[model samples]
Target: MRMGRLRHAMVCSSNQNRSMEAHSLLKRHSFDVASYGTGREVKLPGPSLREPNVYPFGTPYKHMFDELRRKDPDLYKRNGILPMLKRNCSVKLAPQRWQDNAADGCFDVVLTFEEKVFDLVVQDLSNREHKLMKTVLIINMDVKDNHEEAAAGGKLALELCQELEAVDCWEDSIDDIVAAFEKTNNKKLLYNISFY
Candidate 1:
């Protein structure tokens, strides 16, 4: 039961589209927010479904944008990868892996966009020592990994965060907040309580 802005983390498979969109929106609202990927590497759509352009977690967004532009400017631009990379560059330097960010400090809430990412986050948190004994709310709201869906999901994430911030005792009020959010957004959210 603390009162203040809740620190948030938005996670997705690659942190290119969905997470970044939510991160950008949350940041705009002046929320203490960070974003991460659950995937082993950062992956962007390539010319074919089987061929995804992959980069290490630490690869700079600007570098990816340049490389993608050089590889096939028209293709990347048409697919929205270039624009996503451009937007990501403005939000953060690179995509970070969720498993590798344990030292980054604790977050009050972590919102993942997919069930697999939610599972990975839960598993990673479960393996860590509860040094702080601080509870973090991990919520998963399934959002399609696309530009349009990302935009809509970002708004919903913002709305949920607003509801959370309004409550003094979030742990006590979380169930109600989630229920109201689900009713309003018509989206089911899977949540877990984890310790830092």
Candidate 2:
């Protein structure tokens, strides 16, 4: 409704997977895109699932992968996280959290991949001191944390994003955008897949 390419922010529990995948897809479509996590620390497997490495947001994906690969090549390969991390590195500069987005930098729409993240972002937007955030629309479409699931979720997000960009909603309100988006897809833009 703000009438140009809608600025978007995709979020999940960690900036490592789902959000980053959606970020990559949306960015490819030329949407003003950013991604973030709601978690306190960046969580990723080191040598195994039982001992995940906790890192800061801006830590490079390659750096983490290299570290893990150095520690145990077989374990890193078996986890299959390396491929996902490799893909993520090609798109995003680094991992970040939802809190990294400033009030002044709030996007036109903030989409979450999980219900908990949707609630967290809703609250994050609500507590913002900037009134412009009132115009921001937040929607949650559940996506499991895996390669295929993230890819499918990213594709779905792209479709919904395209619909939102194409439609000409007269009213710039959040409700109007939501209504128009749903109307464009002829279905609610909610994806819940268990293929993972």
User: What TM-score goes with each of the models?
Assistant: 0.96, 0.81
What's the lDDT of the predicted structure labeled candidate 1? 0.90
Per-residue lDDT tens digits of candidate 2, residues 1-196?
A: 3345578878888648888889888888778887888898899766556988788878888897787778777876777777777877888767877787544364666788888888877776666565432366677887878778889889888877776677565134446656665676454544221100
For candidate 2, what is the total of clashing residue pairs?
Answer: 0
Residue 149 error, candidate 1, Å = 0.4
Residue-level lDDT for 100 in candidate 2: 72
Give the candidate number with the greatest lDDT. Answer: 1
lDDT of each: 0.90, 0.73
